[model samples]
Target: MTVENEIELTAISGRRSTFEGDPRPGDTLPSMKDSPAVEAGSTMTMTPGLEASRDQLQLQENEEHSIEVLPPVDGGRQAWLFLLGATYMEMLIWGLPFSIGILHVYWTNTLFEGEGASAITLAATLQTGLLYMSCAFFGPMFAALPRWTKTLQVAGLVIGSASVIASAFVTKPWHLIVTIGIFYPMSCACYFPCATLLFEWWHASRGFASGMMYAGTGAGGTIFPFLMQGLLQRFGYKAAMVSLGVGYVVTGLVALIPIKRRIPLSRYDQDGISRIRPRIDWAFSKRKALYLGIMVIGMTSLGNFVPSLWLPSYVDDLGLNKPNGVALVAILNAATALGNGLLGWLSDRMSLRSTILISCVGSAAACAFLWGFGKNSGVLVTFAIIFGLLGPSFSAVWSKIIHLVSKDDPAVTALTFSIFAFVRGVGNMSSGPISESLLKYDTMRGVIGAYGYKNYGILLIYTSITILTGGAAGLFFNKIRDV
Candidate 1:
């Protein structure tokens, strides 16, 4: 209605309203039908404000369509090439760390000799823990400090390579704890923030991109075990470390070639003052999706290292040769890569709830039936593949979880990803000590993975329960989210 009309109605409202059984605030003073306040016939309408939704409607809108002059996004040759470089970066940076299980085997038996399992496991924990924990450093912080990104990335390259090379000269296992476990991983931690680039380049197919990027770690795991085994066996840890260190530097430099941002940037604005970027989104903390992500990632991660770190030893306990153990780790990693890619794709088609349930429950089942009752090498290898497919693929759902929690807001989604990463990292680090305690229960029996996995029966059960619990969280995510 016109302002004059609205004012006319408001001026008469105080006298009385009787157009019907009740009158709204913005109606013309109603002509009283029962009372004699005014004329009985009233010509007026109500203008109560629209309030169907508690939240104000259309507060924000997607601006991508309006930026007609922007460079290509979501898909292009450059975007695909950047993904390739990122995949290789994932392989090089994460290959050795992911396959630390192999080193855990060699060092405990050959290098460390009398050192306890917990002491040896500390090395793997530090390598993974520090790297995973690094998510807190730069992923969200880069918003306030974009200028330092390239500098930090370069510095990390140098430090990471040097750390690996330094590991070659370690005379005692403790020396490795510093060089390989602590320093090297801290250096590589810088790479975690690079994921923002992938997010910028591929908004629509983020799940697939995340999966492909993560699969690099599994791919590296597949190759590194055999390569490290040969080097450790033939030349020793010193030579192997040196060889990997050299390759780390060279390949990383090559990978940097294709790492480009999709958003167009001018030199003057490179510091990001004018650039629209993701901010640290705190609202996610209040959402169920965020907490559910923590449960899934945390539970899976706590049990994750158990298999990768213990599988080789499990083989040895079964009286299988060392090479067989190495082979199984490779198979597990290979299967993990495939599972990640497949599940990532599936997340695009279905809700993350379904994918998470599929991974956790299926993985828990593998732990129970395949790993639990293994009678021979055939069962062991099968367990590795099935568990790898169902268990480690839990990571594939992380991007989708982030999507749900952030509501596709770029700044908030970035922060959510880091929170999830930090949770998983803590899980990886803590599992080392936890698994050590679980190992003391070698005498227990009759649980899942009881037959051939006698030495790790308790550990196997722990892994299964945690994963199943995480899946239960997934199964109920929808119900909780609705509330």
Candidate 2:
């Protein structure tokens, strides 16, 4: 017997469904009155990929059910203090990973000098991959054990700091991957739960609050490059790594002190919490807008790290000094901060599709016209700033995209965030190798460096084209049209 407002969409294992403008025949949203009664405190659990979705639709939020009265939402000292801590972590701990380009250069030419670029690049990919991959696993843990939030954050910082300090002793390239690349990101994983916490503290101001946190990364990028450059030049890579690790130990403790939960631990419904694992729930993937959104995320992520991975080397070939490369990276990072704030605010006021379009078209054009033809320090620096603003800032618009896909349904929102994050993680890991392969041969080596032919002609083409395709992918998500 079919319920009046329910829509039953079955998903095949390992297969993705396609949706277009209209619902397929036999689809309807069952009214809440038609649904059967459920016992209080009951929970639903199922296998990961094999589950079917029979959505008990709530198309609008007419009421909220809760046993406890939480703190205020949107504005308060707790909210602002939490943002300050998050922004601080974003600037320092997270900033180091994004600023890896400078160290990447030093590693290739000085530390592991003469080693294959492929092995060195693996360190970058590994850290970035783990940083995102943790979102899928750790996000739910915090939900399951909200009381463990402080412990988890403290533990993650200790592990990440120890990993970085340990990295100073690596004798082989793979050892660097283990310490700095893998373990360090594992520590950063603790940061993911803040999303849930932020939502709790600032319901109305979520978008603006998120933009502020993301902009901190840009701020870190701007400052860290020069700071790191000075350290590495004066103290050597080992000392630089140790100093940074020590800084993390001191700063992280102070920074994390303000990140408090809005809801009391006693109020949470922690039924069967131990059974939770990093979920792979694709039950909601039947939406056409969702699958299309995933494709866009994966495609853009493939190109997102290209500039950071290759810019230092690209400028080295341009006959620029180490400081010039540092300057370019810093400029790029500062622009990224501005881009995050700008793109996020725009997404709130306009269609999310418009923001994606802006990011894609602007980033692709930067790669093509500016990065591809660059032949001097000035041109490369301009490419850095423009691309930084348009490229990574696309990620800042993710919450809006997910909202459109889920129609503000909170259950689907969490799963979709993890799924999109995982895909982007996979894309980021895959880009290092793909880009290395793209560096095939540079015929214009040492020549006037026309059209980036000096060293990265093929790489530039691949980066720009893939980013454009992502924009094309963005056009297919149907939900954003309503916004």
Candidate 3:
């Protein structure tokens, strides 16, 4: 039969039903294949060639549920309120590190007598390394924690807060490292899963929500420096640490009460089989997840912690005192938060790639132009502002990943995110050391050039270049279509 004739035949054949009740004279037949037929209360006529059309409609519905594209999900008021809690908690969590530059200087000047800039640099790097690396371990763990996510989040907040507060009373490098790096991140890891789950609930608004939550880091970065400086001036480092830590603990506890996973469902085929596999399917390994991993690793490795870890130190090197240095850090973080919101909004409306590209390029230019030849306080402040605003705007990266990937395939989503975390973790691990080395290079006055290039400034130039390359990666990413 011709295709059209076959379609007609199929439609007619599909309508041949065995009804539970007697059919009325005018009652249209139903398809046995499409579940059992009802009585004369309602009737569905089988139109010619509609077999194909019905199949197409069913498939479209299934795809819509699976793909998470088009109009987005049906999140209600509760979901948005949850997002707000997340935004505040995350801001508190992320902001602490952004303000660490001030702490680093404070530690070097007071707590660690004779501890040079390099030692301080290493400490900040380790803090960053722990924070980023924890995400990789926590991402998958968070995904698997069907229960206990909240428990862990609460525990993390408590520990992080207590640790920070307690650390103020200690006077050793290992003490700070153990408290800030290991303990603090361990607590933060509790929220990672909750954050990703938020995306599942708010798929349509995921980019915007993600940006808001991530922007908390920038906001924290912006506010905490000034706060810390003020507290330090008023009550000394120990008192300030206790106050900040207590605030984090209290904020986290309050915020976490409402942060919860939404409705749950089975991942099963209609044939009554679960999608969960007995073992890892090695076959799926050679796919898009791997490429995404490489991209994340390279991009993150380039300049992940420059703003959070190095910017304040660099500012201090430019002849600024403590408060002024802290102010510079605040500017960068505030700017970053602004960038996150602006760029995130644009990503949903425009091409995500284009937004990220612009962000990366802007960061690069700020680093090279503003920081490279920055002579006076004006130039330094300007560089910090521009860099703070534009540098970490790359927060769009995760949002773009979610947009490109299919949410229905949780395995793929989980794997891709795992890889992203892994790469970014590695980058976070190295960024501190790399940045320190660059600073060291810049400090070796009259070695690289006769003009005595400012090592910190030159390193900032390198960071800018690395960030610019990430932009290139985003642009090139457009070519690979089938993820």
Using TM-score as the measure, which candidate wins? 1
Residue-level lDDT of model 1, residues 127-217, one tens digit each, is 8787877777656665555555566666787788998899777677788778877788766544665576676666557778888888887
Q: Is candidate 1 or candidate 3 better by TM-score?
A: 1
Against the true structure, candidate 1 has what lDDT? 0.69
* Stretches of model 1 off by over 4 angstroms after superposition: 1-68, 105-120, 233-236, 264-279, 442-455, 479-483
Candidate with better lDDT, 1 vs 3: 1
The TM-score-based order of candidates, best leading, equals: 1, 2, 3
Q: Indicate whether candidate 1 or candidate 2 has the larger TM-score.
A: 1
Q: Give residue 324's error in model 2 in angstroms.
A: 2.2
Ten-residue stretch with the least lDDT total in model 3: 3-12
C-alpha RMSD (angstroms) for model 2: 10.5
Residue 283 CA displacement from its true place in model 3, Å: 6.9
Q: Candidate 2: where is the Cα deviation over 4 Å? A: 1-69, 105-119, 236-238, 264-283, 321-323, 405-414, 441-452, 478-483
What is candidate 3's lDDT per residue for 111-188, written digit by digit as tens?
Answer: 786755565565566665667667766656655654556777877788878878878877666677667766777765
Query: What's each prediction's TM-score?
Result: 0.78, 0.76, 0.74
Question: What's model 2's lDDT at 433?
Answer: 83
Backbone collisions counted per model: 3, 4, 5
Expressed as tens digits, the lDDT of each residue in 363-452 for candidate 2 is 989988787777777777788888988898777777666655654433345556767778888888888889887687664465434444
